[model samples]
Target: MIEVRRFKKRFGSKEVHRGVSFHVEQGECLGLIGGSGSGKSVLLRSLIGLEKADSGSIVIEGQDITQMTERELIGIRKKVAYAFQGGALFDSMTVFDNLAYPLREHTDLKESDIKKKIRDLLFEFGLADSENLFPGSLSGGMQKRVGLARAIILNPDTILYDEPTAGLDPFNTRKISEMILRLKAKKKTGILVTHDMPVAFEVCDRIALLVHGNLDIIAKPKEIQQDALHPISIFAHGDIT
Candidate 1:
């Protein structure tokens, strides 16, 4: 469902990715783990055209997004949803409005239909009562749930999660894991950028390690764990977070 080939990116004199490459099949979640400044989130953003690569290609379902213009990316963004690390909700808008904003802008669904969809999503994410609350008033976990709920409301074929369980407690983390599993059950494709190893191993079918500006290893979770000599397994137990 997704392929990134010979991807390279630079900011000023610093280059973050050099010939980085990977692929994700449909209905699979690939966990991205890396040391600080390895550009995991940058890779996620590049998929939806949030960060344009300097060279190479990012093809989603057959279309190369790296060659597309900003206007052309508007359509691409709908099929690929990004759940930002901090929820990225509007400070002033209520949760309902925050989730409704995308539907209203990109979809032709009526107000009644939008409300129904939002209500169902909130309920499924255990946030039925949060529809009327603002982002500031909710707990860290609830905000993440709302963000995930909003990201999936469009029923996008792919989801890019940037640290979805970064700051949550165990219960909340498990909740997020369960939610991700639910999405997997529905055959949703995803790329999860997370340093939370337990969650990564629990929810991801495969985990890849980003080192020295490239993906040095990609393997099943058990394979990663068994190879203690590998960079990924060595770094897995480190304080990368």
Candidate 2:
């Protein structure tokens, strides 16, 4: 489980997140929704210690990470994986190399064990045959799959997805949504940052809508569709409040 209590973040003079708080239960897939610059991404970053919070606390499982030293945070970060926006794959390396990079750096596993893990991950991502291909050679959707394979290579307890379905056609977008559902079934807690309502409704177990640097609502998808508090649902679906 994770908790964000009265979190606040600032950049220069701009306060990105102001007094934001929420909780994600273990094995829960929570969607963070908001328009651009609404602080959804900032919140995700803060939760994983990628971005420091100027005030408030982010506790994961019971550890308050707001004041942890860099060395202390490293161990905590290993259990949290992040799938960045646009599936940021290494353009120079082959898919196999990209996926193997994490295990090489983080774990003391032997070469054979690493190879076996990489093979399994590639197979799971449906890119077993494309392991030798560079990111440039594969299509955008394939690249995204490789990126996801790499992120899960460490088998992190919690995964943070930043715009997982951006820049894809409807077909690829749905594929990623299905992947999110599959990940949830595996008991991986997911924090998805996206503005796509349909994707949220399909994949997320719960949705938290951010408006004006605060969480407007956190409810089940069915409740969100029925409730009238979320302004984005009104504009995105033309539902009367």
Candidate 3:
């Protein structure tokens, strides 16, 4: 559903993405794993036009987003939802309002329908009672669940996750992984950018290791595990000494 080819991005004298290329098929969750400063987040931003690439093509379902204008991108953004690392919930909005914001902005669904949708999502994410609470009142795990619930409330075809399990406890991390797996079962495409190796192995159908601004290896979890000498193995499992 998504294709990136020869993608290159730079920050002044520093280059972030150098000819990086990869694809995520429909119903597949591809994990993007990399060390610090590897530009994984920047690549995710570029997919949504939050960051412009210097030269390359990012095509989603046959449309090249690299050349799309802000107006043109509105439609694409609806089909591609991004779940930010820190939840990114509106501090001023209540949890219910935050969850309803996208539907109110993007769809003509009636207020009643919107409410139903929000309630269903909250229940699905195990947050049925959090609607009235503010983001600050929630725990880190609750906030992450709320962020994910908001991201999928619109039923976008593609979901881009940035550090979904960054600071959560093991239980919450497992919850996040289960959520990703649930999304995959429903045939949603996803690109998960995370440093959590266990989450990657548990949820992603394929894992792509980013090294030196490009995908050094893309393989299934078992393949990655079997190839001890592969760069991904080295990075994910450490030097097997």
Candidate 4:
């Protein structure tokens, strides 16, 4: 459902993405694993047109987003949702309002309908009681769940997750992992940018290792795990020897 070809991005003298390329098929979750400063998050932002690429194509369902105008991208944004790493919630808004914000802005649904949608999503994400709470009141894991809940509140065709399981305990990490798997079960297309290898292996149908601003390897979890001597595997395992 998403294809990136020969993508390149730069900031001043630094090149963030140098001819990076990858694809995520419909109903497939592709994990993008890379170290800090590898441009994984930037690539995710570029997918939804939040970060414009210097060159190359980012095609979603055959539309080249790189060439689209901001007005034109509004429709694409509805089809592709991004869940930010730090829960990016509006500190002033309650959780219900935060989840309802997208629907209220993007759809013509009535207030009652919007409330229903928010209630359902809260229940789905185990945030039913969190509707009245603010981001500061929640735990790290709860905040992450709320972030994810807001991302899918629109029922987008594709979801881009940036460090979904970051900074969470093992229990919460497992919950987030299971939530991702549940999304996969329902045939959701996703690109997961995470440093959590176990979560990546557990949830991704294919894993893409980004190295030196490019995709160094793209393979199934087992394929990657079995080749411990491979550069990507070694990097993932932190075994430089």
Candidate 5:
């Protein structure tokens, strides 16, 4: 569903992604594992058109997002949502409003239908009782779940998850993992950039190890464990530190 070919991105003199190429099939979740500053999240941003590639192409469903104007990218953004690492909720708005903002901005759904949609999402993500709560009042896990609820509030075709499980306790991490699996079961495609190995193993169909501006290995989660590449081996065995 998504293809990135020779994606090269640089910030000033720092080149992050150099000739990086990978693809994520429909109904598959690709786990992106890499060290800090490896530009894993840069790929996620590039997919949704938030980040631009200097000298490559990011083709999603046949259209190259790099060439899309802001107006054209609006349509792509609606189909592909980016779930930020820190939840990125609006502190000024209540959870209900935060989730409602997108529906109101992007669609013409009636107030009644929007209310029902928000209610269902909150309940599905286990935040029914906290709809009136603001991001500040929610726990870290609760905030992340609420953020995710807002993300899929549009039923996007694909999700770009940037460090979804970062900083969570084990219990919350499992909850997030289960949530991703539920989405996968529904046939939603995704690119998950995470350092949490267990979460990656649980939800991804294939894991790609990125290092030195390119993907060093791309294989099934179990196959990644047996890969002989140096970076893949250390990352798989948790010896990167």
Candidate 6:
């Protein structure tokens, strides 16, 4: 459902994604793993159109989104959603309002319909009673769940996660990973960029290893384990592969 061809992104003199290329099928959970400064996050942002690539083509569904105008990108963006590392919830807004904001801005749904949608999402993400609470009042895990709810509010065809479980304890990490799987089961094409090896293996249908600004290898977890070229082996076993 997502195809990136020869994607190249740079920040001034530094190149982050050097001729990166990959494709994600519909309803597949693709894990992107890499060490710090490996350009994984930069590629994720570029994939989602948050950071325009210096040179490349990003096509989702069927449209080439890399060079689309902002007006054209709006409708395309509605078909994709991104969950940032920190949840990125508005501290000034309550959970209900936080969920409602996107619906209000993007759709013509009335307030009563938006209320019902928000309530349903709150319950779905296990935040039923916390609708009145602000994000600051929630735990780290709870905040992430809220972020997931918001990301799926529009029922996008693709979801991009940037370190979905970055700052949580182990229990919360598992919870987030399970949520990622569940979201994929619900038929949303998932692109999970995580540093956690166990979580990536547990949730991803396929894994892509990003190293030194290029896509080093892309395979299933078992295939990755068997392939000598897998960059994750170097990451997990210190060049022992």
What does candidate 5's lDDT look like per residue over 1-241, in tens digits?
9999999999999988889998899989999999888999988888988888898898888999999998999999998988999899999999999999999999999999999999988888888899898899999998888888889899998988999999999988888888899999989998999998888988999889888888857888777666666566677676763
TM-scores for the candidates: 0.96, 0.92, 0.97, 0.96, 0.96, 0.93
Candidate 1 on 1-241: residue-level lDDT in tens?
Answer: 9999999998999889998999999999999999878899999999999999999999998999999999999888888989988899898999999999999998899999999999988988999998999999999999998998889888899999999999899999999999999999999998999989999999899999887788868989988778887667788878343
TM-score of 6: 0.93
Clash list (residue pairs), candidate 5: none
Candidate 4 wrong stretches, greater than 4 Å:
none
Q: Which ten residues in a row have the lowest lDDT in candidate 2?
A: 232-241
Give the poorly placed runs of model 2, Cα more than 4 Å off: 228-232, 238-241
lDDT of each: 0.91, 0.84, 0.91, 0.91, 0.89, 0.86
Query: What clash pairs does model 6 have?
Result: none
Q: How displaced is residue 187 in candidate 2, in Å? A: 1.2
Evaluate residue 53 in candidate 6 and report its C-alpha lDDT on the 0 to 100 scale: 80
Candidate 4: tens digits of C-alpha lDDT, residues 136-207: 999989988999998988888899999999999998898889888898898999999999988998999999
Q: Of the candidates numbered 2 and 5, which has the greater lDDT value? A: 5
* Model 4, C-alpha of 33: deviation from truth (Å): 0.7
lDDT of 6 by residue, 1-241 (tens): 9999999988889878899999999999999987787788888877767888889899998888898877888887788898988889999999999899889989999999999999987877778999999999999888998998898899898899999899899988877787788788889898999878778878889898887788858878887678656667667665631
Q: What are the candidates' C-alpha RMSDs?
A: 1.4, 2.2, 1.6, 1.4, 1.5, 2.0
Model 1 regions more than 4 Å off: 239-241
Candidate closer to the true structure by lDDT (higher is better), 2 or 6 = 6
TM-score of 1: 0.96
Compose the digit string of candidate 3's lDDT tens values, residues 149-189: 88888899999999999999999998889999999999999
